[model samples]
Target: MATPTVEKFLLEVSRVLRERNGPQLQDILVIEPPLPPLYNLMVNELRNAFPSGQDDALEDKCTRALPEYVEMEDGSSWTAFIKFMRQYFCFLRDVNVENLVETFQLLRNLVKQSVNALGHGSMGVVLLPTVIAFSRALTKLTIALHKKPQLIAHLIRRQAADESGSRSTLVDTAADVLRDAFSGCLNDRSVTGAGVGSDGRPMGKKISIYVIANLCLKLYFECDKIRSAEQIFVNIQNGSPPLSLYPASQRVTYLYYLGRYYFVNNHFYRAQLALQSAYDGCHSKCVQQRSRILPFLITACMTLGRFPSQALLRRPEAAGLAEKFLPICRAISRGDLATFRSFFGPEGPHTDYFLRRRLLLPLRDRCEVLVWRSMARKTFLLAGSQGDPGARKAPTFDLHDLLRLTQVLERRSFGQTQKKPIGKTHTNSIFMFQNSQQNGIKPELYVDPDVKGVAEPAGPPEPTMLDIESMVSSLIYQGFLGGFISHRQLRFAIRGAKEKGSLNAGFPNVWEVIKSRSSDAVPGWKRDEVSSVRNGVSRPPGPGMVIHLSGARPAGTPPM
Candidate 1:
């Protein structure tokens, strides 16, 4: 049954292996010219075989003769293993799973035979090189198939959608195949443990993990497997050398995928830190990747009331975000709600992206802060101007007027966002929520034993200086409006001179704000009890609608 051409090749290889040392072993195999090639091919025939493509058939035919060559009196297992692997990679697409299984089995037999002949020293020296080559082949195979899992998903959804069989079946099959292969290989951490391979090198878990991470980087954008991928990263995070010890590109990609997972889950601080690390580690030549990460990075910073540094903003990769958000940034700093609305309106160009990313709610909160600060400034000016000319105490800005001011600012702010269909509903919902605050006698921060229970007003209690002051207190605590509320009057002023620079910088300079307040009221700093909820989060009472404060939380609880 043997082909005459293959019979000649096997006879030559067996003869050379019998007489050869390392140089002759290297040369006859034609591994490289400076090394020996003891038995690969006649020079003319080797020249005719070509480098790749159909030449894989020629290589496969030659490799099938490997065991025949090894069975010859003096032929060795090392030559058969190397020859089989070279042919396998060369004809990778055509190789079946059974053939692959046979190959690893051959590897085990070959390595153990080498260990017996060369003694224990050969276990490390001989098997180490073989292990390295085996790893590279698996890595190469993994890289080749890396996109298949996602490709299968897309094909099912797009090309097979609506078919009677159901596209999900194909998708599930593809996911199952990849999941089993990747998980099994990566989970086996003890590569060199005695019983692992039984006869040879166990599959190296390190290379498998790196390879799977590469696939996950691609899969992350392709499907909903992020949670699984995140867990994989976590489980392997403490591996011997650590994932950080992987190639730089793999580490950067892992951080990016990890950061995106955290971002979607609303862990802003961790997301910010992870994204920043990814951005820092990004290669200089990878401009598009750097550009892709900028928007999420910008939004994460904004949610925490901060901005990326000017140096970071100046990069060409960040130009688009800087152009779109700079106006809102400046508006926030100036406490100019009108301009913030102009740039940040729901119908503005980037609105859908922000909403999809769940950043719109936080942006809306910042807008309220700007509007509330303006309202506070107006209240301060009115207090200075009105009431008795020689009055010892400043006249209170009427609760009615402040309520009306909030309505006007809210209307204008929402009006800008009203172009989109959902924008109208969002505006109406916020308006109704704020109006409810004015229709009741809300609890004040007062701890008076005499005022044991809230008095039920005959009708909704008209907004008072106490109610107004409570709204201000809530805003201060939430880090929305930077300045402190007056304990005596409901007046809101810009924070002390030193912190004026960072007032609307997004992050509240809390220590400065608290330091400016008198020490007397610090112990039981009054907190407004928010009675309203929208979409599950509590909102402060009155027009400016700050975020909720828990039951009687101390004012000092705000972080510096």
Candidate 2:
């Protein structure tokens, strides 16, 4: 009783649906009238062709009718239709009552057709919706059939290889696709009727998460975009506490990527926390996964300045983590190259050479302490030009020499060893002092150092008491004092100073100066001012002046 045009359209749609050629179905169904009967007939044919065993046929009829009013001429309309077919295919794929896997090849053809339509720009208006739909359907199919991850991974890689436009534009398109797919999975709530689960939870949630995680990682690798991955992870972390997932292995995988995301962003503190949690969640027997994550965990700990356990440090598994990284301390110490190379495996020689060339060599030259030593060596060479061979001491500014000095100093001051290289700026200042001593520069030790004499021909003098006070005042003027120093830091520095006399002797004073200036309450600075004045004038402060200032202050005012 149907018109020939109607029958011909029905036959083509039937062929596409039977073939599971969703893309072809999309093309044939693009121009259909918004008629309930037409939709109902199509639904009847599909259901009869692929039956769900306890079906109220009317439910299919109503579900199919919902797509009738959706237009396909505009992007929004096309998006909607794509969404519909996506869900439709997902429902077909997941319905346990049906044998959809046998028909998946046919469905793949339609998926291919839809992709081709998108490429041709005929489906531009609905490209996003179509993408979302296809992803949802693909996710459902994978979950229902227990498909391997490589299949989806291959599809994503192929799409990324298109090479069609500016790099930024291509990345943006890929990002949009991932974003839409993520949105679809989060919004989908039709699990019960689709036979996915009885509790209205889609069987696809885990698979969806897996696919999105891999896709996000691919996006990060290919395009270097991370926001999508970050959002997906944040959502997962906030939506459910990971421990609730029975197969903790899958959840740990998510945590791995989450930690990696933070690590790549240079958020080592957070990366350490997340990676540690992942390691804790894994079974004790899963040594391979633990081996895979150990290096990242160690790197995070190193970056955060946390000392890793000796067990982790000595484990053969730790070699992978230590191998590529050239820790500043280790490189400076010139630890065993063979040990270092063992981490890089067969590429050890090449990697070791590059590491020495690019990092160790440049670092040695630019680092301040070494710079001071080099200058001292030059000065000693020049001084000997007048023929005083007996006056020369062996050059004593090697890495071991510095390490021994730092260890001794740290032990005397802090009662504990520092576990990492000190900042280059601070280390350089100490090196200069050592070089001055070695070169017989006779650095004047005075109670009140003169400020002007501190200036070198090379550059301005290091900061004096007055200069530090003024700098603090400037920072306070800009309202940056509160941000730079906290009350606790001030207390710690003060406590540290009382235990070690003349805290002003080293870089610790720099921290103190910044702290005192930023504090709401001022600090006593008689010693600092006296040291500065004495150094600048190359003379000692008389006892009478100290007594006069001590007597001049009011009851509670700090001496300055």
Candidate 3:
């Protein structure tokens, strides 16, 4: 049977709605079935409208189509379809299983139409509703996925699922198709074209890219398709119009999702930078949105092996969440695995929330590493406390103790219920965790030291000496642990360093505002008000990372 077109289907819908108000109308009958076909038809129209490889023809086609859109369709059916679309597309209406697939297809089609129907920049303002629609869809869909894994199967069949349960790549679908459409059109914007704006950008192009990127990220994050999201972001970052052209809100949102993508992949430093950008630009009105970014921001720091220097979480507004994280911060800093587990375990306030987003494990790595590194640190400290004035802190950690430590960390930190040691000692004595795809610790167990816990080298009449050196190497490489491993002595040297001479960039204004009329009851050297003001002003302060984006200051910046 041939599928009916939405325009033809809308004739009946208009009649039904005309009789009874839309409130009583079944969404399935009026809004769902015809949508997929409409989307396909619109895409076909866009493919024909926005031709590729012909710069001259592309411009001519866009100009010609502008007039057609203004006067092309029947007033009754198409208008109603688009009006209902405006509501559904902008997330003003509800969508159910019957219509969800069609809704995504509709969103993709709307973008395709918007991208191709370019004219004056201001005229393109209507395109933003499509982005808003997409944002809501992605948020809802991602949440739904936790409840319904196959939610988007009707619209985009995920071929990523396999016997080995890991999502590596998504099957080619609407997201990729939209990407191709956008890429093909972007190919035609002349580098030196007259469309360049007062801000030295191509008119009508930057805003479209801004809107499109936000949607692309939702596909990656919400749709559970990592490679597609990465592809879209890389494309934008490398060559597309500058994202900064978008408003602060859009920029913040894009960077936030981008940061999350980076976070999951163990790219903590880059994730920190992107998330920091989001947090910095976040305004007071969007506290809920800002709150969403906060836990991830803190996660980025923990992964990097430290708590942020700034009192970000201690702010009056942020204290609620920060108070909970404070225990975690102290636990990880001191390498207290027992306490760390209690703070982030099942009953912890933030654990379940962060776990829902797949963020807690990333946070746990640093804690694991901290526990192991702290052991090594104590070994060095104990040795250094010997009678010799020049005694270096050295690893005297016993072989069985190391094994016991590793076993406990594996079970506790990883939720690894497997009651066995992960590896045997090599002849060179390097302790390597067996890369078990079965256990899914191939990366987190060995390559990533921040993932936590230590694998110890067990010695025997067996040719292998304990391989403590290799395990320590991995930890130091990722910045989770400090000092080098001594292969000759078969010990991990513990050299603890501190961030001495660090200046607090976030508190300069607070110091300036301090109107201390003598010290309030504290015994102190009472300095003149003028002297205090001069000291505060003469500190040679520098600009810090944007507000709320607390991290170690970039190196080579003069101390504030």
Backbone collision count in every prediction? 9, 23, 8
Give lDDT per model, in order.
0.50, 0.42, 0.50
Residue 418 error, candidate 1, Å: 5.0
TM-scores, one per candidate: 0.49, 0.36, 0.52
- Model 1, clash count? 9
Over 1-560, each residue of candidate 2 has an lDDT whose tens digit, in order, gives 22344345435544553454545544544321243565555555545544554334433433344443244344333333334444343344233324444334434444444443343223332333444355444434434443344434544566678687334333344445555555444434432333135543334332254445455454553344665566666554433222333256755665666676776666555666668877878776787887767666765654333436556656655554443444433532232222322333322334454353223222222222222222222322333122222553221112223233333332432322133333344445643564445545466643235564664453323334343334333433433222122223221011122234212211132223433444321111011123325536754654323334645766889867
How displaced is residue 37 in candidate 3, in Å?
A: 26
Kindly indicate the candidate among 2 and 3 with the higher TM-score.
3
RMSD of each: 18.8, 22.9, 16.2
List the lowest-lDDT window of 10 residues for candidate 2. 520-529
**Model 1: lDDT of residue 62:** 55
Model 1, global lDDT:
0.50
Give me the runs in candidate 3 sitting further than 4 Å from their true place. Answer: 1-196, 200-202, 308-310, 316-320, 341-351, 386-470, 473-560
| Model 1 pairs in collision | 26-36, 27-36, 27-37, 27-38, 28-36, 28-37, 28-38, 28-39, 29-38
Residue pairs in steric clash, candidate 3? Answer: 365-450, 365-451, 369-452, 429-465, 429-466, 429-467, 430-467, 431-467
Candidate achieving higher TM-score, 1 or 2: 1
Alpha-carbon shift of residue 191 in model 2 (angstroms): 6.9
